[model samples]
Target: MKTTLTVLLIIQLYGLASCAIKQHYFINQMKTWDEARQYCRTNYHNLSTFINEIEKQQFLQDAVNQTSDAWIGLNKPSGTWKWTTGEVTTQISWDTGEPDNDFCAYLHKDSKKLHDRDCSNTQTFFCMKVTVNTVMVQQSESWEGALEYCRHHHDDLASLSSSRSMTDALSKITGAQTQYVWIGLRFLAGGWFWISGDDLILNVWSSAGPPQCPAQNQRCAALDKNTQTWTPRDCEEKLNFLCFK
Candidate 1:
């Protein structure tokens, strides 16, 4: 009886260990911001969606062995905060007074704390790929020029009818930080609209607000630098655009 009981206890312990969540890491090196993001989404799951405090703590602990910073799926284009995974940010784990719309998001090496960064700057990043494979691409475009550029190259700016579509798009183009691309979206007729003319459904505007309708003189849209939200600006203003095929 004693031997049988010991065997059963060992079996129970094994089952508990099996149920524990498995954490994986990818120490990607020498990739642009966009490329790093794409790598994580395509190779792993969506780029490290840290929704709660526990996950954030675990991620930092996991990265304790690493020496460089890693890139999570947080970016501000045209003044809107979005995850490369395509799911809207229902919850966030930013450090106190963080995501101030400075420009970008980075994970510090020592503290593993995430910081907002400028999109133009370059940095190394770590990508957390999940067991479930998903991808998405959220393009940022404002004016007719950028819109035309995307239409000419990739499909219209990004549209997410469901979470699956968002994940698929993100997986396709993970690493991007080199050049910004254009999406199939713009401010038209006093409202936010997609190139497909779909209703303004998924609103992810930053702190400021949505892009205003283009004025007669100003025929384009540009993201506000301070707020990281969309606003009406001259299309002629030069800015890097995001494109996905």
Candidate 2:
């Protein structure tokens, strides 16, 4: 029994360390998207491209410190967005019917999605080193409090976009976990969606399907580590959570 407990502890710590993300610099100075790109290339890696909530939160926190919206590495100038480094990764989480008639984009905290705007619009920007980190919050708390804890300590709660990502996150669960833990899944704007603005393409809800749509009383979602399925629970329900950084 002691050996088993030791193994679980080791796995938990190793999971957190394995997903650690690279650092980023918050340039609170407002600049055009093009200008920001040049500045990032010259001084840092490049305009930040975030594939998951962990990276997105890093930039979002930086943006909040500034006075206005901020330009990220995401842009759909012409049609599709290409990172500042010139690689065109297919992973894109767009708001409903977005990426229309715009050359540049900025991160919106309210919707937590890429909103297209004129490239010339000057805004603060973020430059990231390109990395990902995952952390498990063993402290039980309500969903809202869990969010606050994540923001105050690491990033936001873990958001799963793809099956691979979800599976990877589930693997971090070490010991036998009977209770549900909070994730970034929630019902918002008339549909189930990830807090990171990622589309709700993959869902492993209960056999009877997920809880009723347009959830009642600010209901949030949690991950059943044992079953690896999602379930809607009261926002006030205190539970352990997962945070990505």
Candidate 3:
């Protein structure tokens, strides 16, 4: 029997519930940015990161207090601003005339805006607890079609950049119709990369080591539902996909 590749473009399913967002918490204790981050990591997921204006406003409304400035997850570690989740900061809400010479960002209690400060500056902070990080779309689509649908409807296709993220992604795919589900991993420009811009540092590949040079058609990655490991597959093989939100 010969297997044929099929390209299926799926329509957006509006009725499906979106992926769970992070839950923010306010800690009133004064601590440096590093201290705050450690506390958040020890207790919750990480320092709070906002992806949009609505999320920012909701976090501020719930987590901001009048007593002190608050450290968030935004920081410039190597001259590039990034969230602790490994995603680069793009939709920022910096205060006017801010981010001068500083590497860490803190939320102003009064202004409700982000201002850059020294990492050593003592302040209260916000932390977030991520519940479900991605949503499994049951609709089957090719790798390119899945990427397009995910980018159009939510964030990029899910990127299991860490062990915890891989666990989170695994939890969402129990109901997938396909044996393997499409992820954001792709072989491109001579290397494998995540569409969300996270480093492919965590190795969850199966027994087979990373493919040095995959076949032209076998450039997309999918997660084996039983093994919970990543494997390269034909880009045209339609499968249910996970989308980060």
Candidate 4:
């Protein structure tokens, strides 16, 4: 059986893992904020928008290059800051004394924080593609088999890295044939990890909490449909599973 100590060490790196819940694209070409937005919409989904600190940190580590300050998806329209998704800016990652009455936001490469600038200023920008589509496969298969199936047919096993993704996954599993369904979560090497390489940012474990060290065969994670929580289960057990596409 795997020991709890081994698993705990892996949990410490949960937030450091990389996955495709959100993808950032750096555009080196200089363009005005409006021009950058149009370019992003034409090529990618939109300009980048960080949903939380974890995402912000991950983006800095994964995408930001040696470029200077760059345009993000934040802009003041009608005297209010909003993301490219049209969501009003709530959580702030502003640098010291920022928003200095400017109408557009740029991310400083050094501080990795948001600062306002004139909308007409030309700069390289970042674009992002956000996708969290989860599909429940009613076919029952063991954890390992399911992983292979998903990798062959779809993107990978579903990774609920956030509350929104969790909710989205839940919606697809309501009609699942099994009470528990395999997700991308698995205890491997020394810790539990998402097979899809996603960072485990959400805490949706059962009331009993995650097993520190599961038994040799009970190292895989499954989602409890009725309770909407995660639980360790035997990897060999056959069950329905979710896939990302």
Highest-TM-score candidate: 3
Model 3 ranges off by over 4 Å: 1-20, 28-43, 78-97, 109-111, 120-123, 131-140, 151-156, 161-165, 175-177, 198-203, 207-218
Candidate 4 positional error at 228, Å: 0.5
Off by over 4 Å in 4: 1-129
Candidate 4 lDDT at 128 equals 77
Instruction: Give the candidate order by descending TM-score.
Output: 3, 4, 2, 1
- Per-residue lDDT of candidate 3, residues 25-72 (tens digit): 889899999999878876776788876667777787777454678899
How much does each candidate deviate from the true structure in C-alpha RMSD? Answer: 19.7, 14.8, 6.3, 12.3
Better of 2 and 4 by lDDT: 4
In the range 56-81, model 4's lDDT, one tens digit per residue, is: 77677656473778899888879888
Q: Which residue pairs collide, candidate 4?
A: none
- Among residues 3 or more apart in sequence or in different chains, the pairs in candidate 3 whose N, CA or C atoms overlap within 3 Å are none
- Candidate 4 CA-lDDT value: 0.78
User: Candidate 2, 58: how far from true, in Å?
Assistant: 16
TM-score of each: 0.41, 0.48, 0.67, 0.53
Model 3, residue 32: C-alpha shift (Å): 5.5
* lDDT-best of 1 and 3: 3
What C-alpha lDDT does candidate 2 achieve relative to the native structure?
A: 0.67
- The 10-residue segment of model 1 with minimum total lDDT is 13-22
lDDT of 2 by residue, 97-188 (tens): 87778878777656666778899988888776534555777788877678668766886677765565566668765442337888877664
Best by lDDT: 3
Predictions in order: lDDT: 0.49, 0.67, 0.79, 0.78
TM-score between candidate 4 and the true structure = 0.53
The residue ranges of model 2 lying beyond 4 angstroms of the native Cα positions read: 1-131, 176-178, 208-218
